[model samples]
Target: MRAGSFGQLTQDKENTTQVTFHYVEGNTETFTIPIPASEFQEEVLQLLNQPWLTFHLVDQTVFICTARLIKVEIKPAIPELQGQGIFSNSMRVSTMQRAAAGRLPMNT
Candidate 1:
């Protein structure tokens, strides 16, 4: 099994988040994750500055690793919703998309 590495999260593309892994004890391991559009909220953004983040592996095992924000490449344009925006068309779009995908929980 490979030990998870410590690093930061970056957008590898419009639909992917890349995890840059660096090992302090053994070989560094890295990976990427797909996140919901709602992940752009301010609360989540602050999480990027946290010292460490707890991750649950696919095996149900937990991994605690330090998150270092070495740098961030500024994109030429912000995302349509900038990962977070309320009271706008983007919010409406997100809702519609979720409903279409059958992700929105039914009230009854």
Candidate 2:
């Protein structure tokens, strides 16, 4: 599981209570996803054309991406009642390392 802030809230009626959060799975990579402002959903579907990419939301705004199915945990969000305005949130991501299987390397 990971933790972060829901950066900003959108004005759209359907998105008013949603916030976007930025997260990184490993050391230097980053992933971002938008979710409901106050609730955490079990599953999240992300639109990606690539077949090797997958996305998962840990909390309302924090998300993670991986190519394999792994265990994930979610943490509680720290409500910021003082700042009800819209803003962007940043988060940190954690991932488990796995051994690579024998496969032909792809050529660029």
Candidate 3:
């Protein structure tokens, strides 16, 4: 139920592995699997090595696409703030936030 950007991802030692998938069309899905804490890396590696990611849900299994490509079709990009000065960052942030908030001028 999120819009605009690929949503957040939070991981910690106390929880199982979780991954969120975002599509080119703006759809998203998340899958969480309770796995042995010691096998976290192994599990992730196994999944990433496969062609697609599998989700073993309660009722059924879901397969998500995982093809990798060098180029992606992206909409107008929000400039990433790097090591710029504070004022420059602030202005870019304002512009990006406004665009994300759907406040762009009609001509744009």
Tell me the TM-score of each prediction against the true structure. Answer: 0.34, 0.20, 0.43
* lDDT of residue 9 for candidate 1: 26
Residues 9-102 of candidate 3: C-alpha lDDT, one tens digit per residue: 3333234544566676667666665653445544443555678766778899988766642222212122332243413323235767877778
lDDT of 2 by residue, 1-108 (tens): 233323322233233232233335323333333444343342322222223443455653423344433332223332442333523375544332222322446678
lDDT of each model, Cα atoms only? 0.46, 0.35, 0.51
For model 1, residues 1-108, the per-residue Cα lDDT tens digits are 234322222233544444545545544555444643345332344655667766566766536355434433222223543433323443325767867779656788
- How many residue-pair clashes does candidate 1 contain? 0
Q: What is the lDDT of residue 70 in candidate 1?
A: 48
**Pick by TM-score: which candidate is best?**
3
Cα error, candidate 2, residue 39 (Å) = 6.4
Off by over 4 Å in 3: 1-15, 36-38, 68-108
Any idea what lDDT model 2 has? 0.35
The lowest-lDDT stretch of 10 consecutive residues in candidate 3 is: 69-78
Better of 2 and 3 by TM-score: 3
lDDT of 3 at 58: 88
Summed backbone clashes in each candidate are: 0, 5, 0
